[model samples]
Target: MTLSLTAQDKNTLRTAAYGAVSLIAAADATGSPHKIATHGSIALASATGPVGHVLAEKSKIAGLDGKTVAELADHVLPALTAAMNLLREQDPAQAETFRSTVGIALDAGVGARKGEPGPALTEMRRKISTALDAA
Candidate 1:
């Protein structure tokens, strides 16, 4: 069976994803609220820009456009895996911090909303943490 997302749905997903990236970036930069940092905290701040750009660009690619949530998750998994791997190699502690901070954000942002039909952010965070831990 074919699955699709309306333009509004895609825009919503993009906004949420970008918002998460922005929150991370801001936290890494100022270290006030979340304080999520890497060994090279300055570098981490720089890295997030490209990561955010890539996520925005890739999500709108032909194959990913109109995909269901699960399908979109599958498509993005490799990028997420690669990112977690890179972070772990750079700073294991910071990688763990990344996962935790992301989890916290997702809990507040996505988890708080009732009746959302898709993969739980908690589950997604678990997968990311597991991957980082294994690495």
Candidate 2:
């Protein structure tokens, strides 16, 4: 079966991706001095709401509180992967665009924090790209 995504679906996925990255950054910020700073905050906020709203929305979708980074990642990654797969099957161009946009967003998020992304974010990026390749 071909899985198709409407514009709304793409928007949801985009929002979710931003939320996921924000969730990870917030978690990292707790322990590290580096935070998303001004640019990252603006980037994320422009897409979704504040970081807290994104986390809450994603958490509600994942059916988890997402109190910790691990918990959030566990839920967000799988959802994102699935969404990518569906988008790839329905519209390859859109899938590519999503992947690129998410990658750029993630990078901006990390750059704002002035630190490297952890393994989870990297893995999610890889998974999104791989889904497109596999399709």
Candidate 3:
């Protein structure tokens, strides 16, 4: 919830977030970050808080109730990217902080939703945390 990330990790998350968006946007002819930027913007709006609130709010609005893991990720990722991009243009520093915070939240969300790479990411985080704690 309040993880302290290194600058590099922050950048990594930002890149991943944006990359996920690009992937989804390119996959669909009509989907763009602008179309769903609102959802992600909310998440980025809160840099010092857990991003679960924003993501959950968007999920509810998107009718994620009965959707498959892949379906939810497909929808949420793009929206988040669009929002993050918009937030960056609005406030780069704040958006960067929020991007890293949301990265953790997004990873957890994917795992909870049984997304395609959710388990892998969850496991990787666990391993990384363990290793870091041991250091």
Candidate 4:
């Protein structure tokens, strides 16, 4: 049987995934808010450019091999999150832009997953939101 998800369900999943992943990403990162802010900003700048495209390409390549969306999400989410975390730690302003970019990417990924953001993108969004809140 095939199951379908509504748009609200997809967005809710994305939000939850992002919140959980951000907590994990931030686990080892602790310091004054300023330091955290600096780090997050840098991380954002570094990730803002190509990470999203890379993940989308990866997803497309994986799909060609008949990989499940779940498989693709599992593989891509951590790399995306880690890259963004690094950017967030280095530059907060850029981090904000990156977060917004992730949101857009997540919107796209949701369609790929049949209205749900893939696990990786969802998780990445969580981390992005957390870093933004921190800044």
Best by lDDT: 2
- Name the lDDT value of residue 8 in candidate 2: 49
Ten consecutive residues with minimal summed lDDT in candidate 4? Answer: 57-66
Of the two candidates 2 and 4, the one with more favorable TM-score, higher being better, is 2
| TM-score, per-candidate, Cα-based | 0.41, 0.57, 0.37, 0.34
Model 2 pairs whose backbones collide: none
Stretches of candidate 1 above 4 Å error? Answer: 1-66, 115-134
Off by over 4 Å in 3: 1-60, 106-119, 122-135
Estimate every model's Cα lDDT from 0 to 1. Answer: 0.39, 0.52, 0.40, 0.38
Lowest lDDT 10-residue stretch of candidate 3? 57-66
Return the lDDT, model 1, position 61.
32
Candidate 1 local lDDT, residue 19? 38
Query: Candidate 4's residue-wise lDDT over 1-135, tens digit each?
Result: 122334433333233233333333233233232333233333323343433322222111221121443443344454345444544565544445555655553333333222333454446455545544543
Candidate 1 structure lDDT = 0.39
Model 4 misses residue 113 by how many Å? 12
Candidate 4 residue 91 C-alpha distance from true site, Å: 0.8
lDDT of candidate 1 over 51-130, digit per residue (tens) = 33323344443323323445544444443444455556555554455555444544444332344424344455555445
Best by TM-score: 2
lDDT of candidate 3 over 1-135, digit per residue (tens): 244444433443444343343222223323332332333333433434333333222221322322443554545444445545544655565455555655544343333322254344445344333322221
The true-versus-predicted C-alpha distance at residue 15 of model 4, in Å, is 20
Off by over 4 Å in 4: 1-66, 108-135
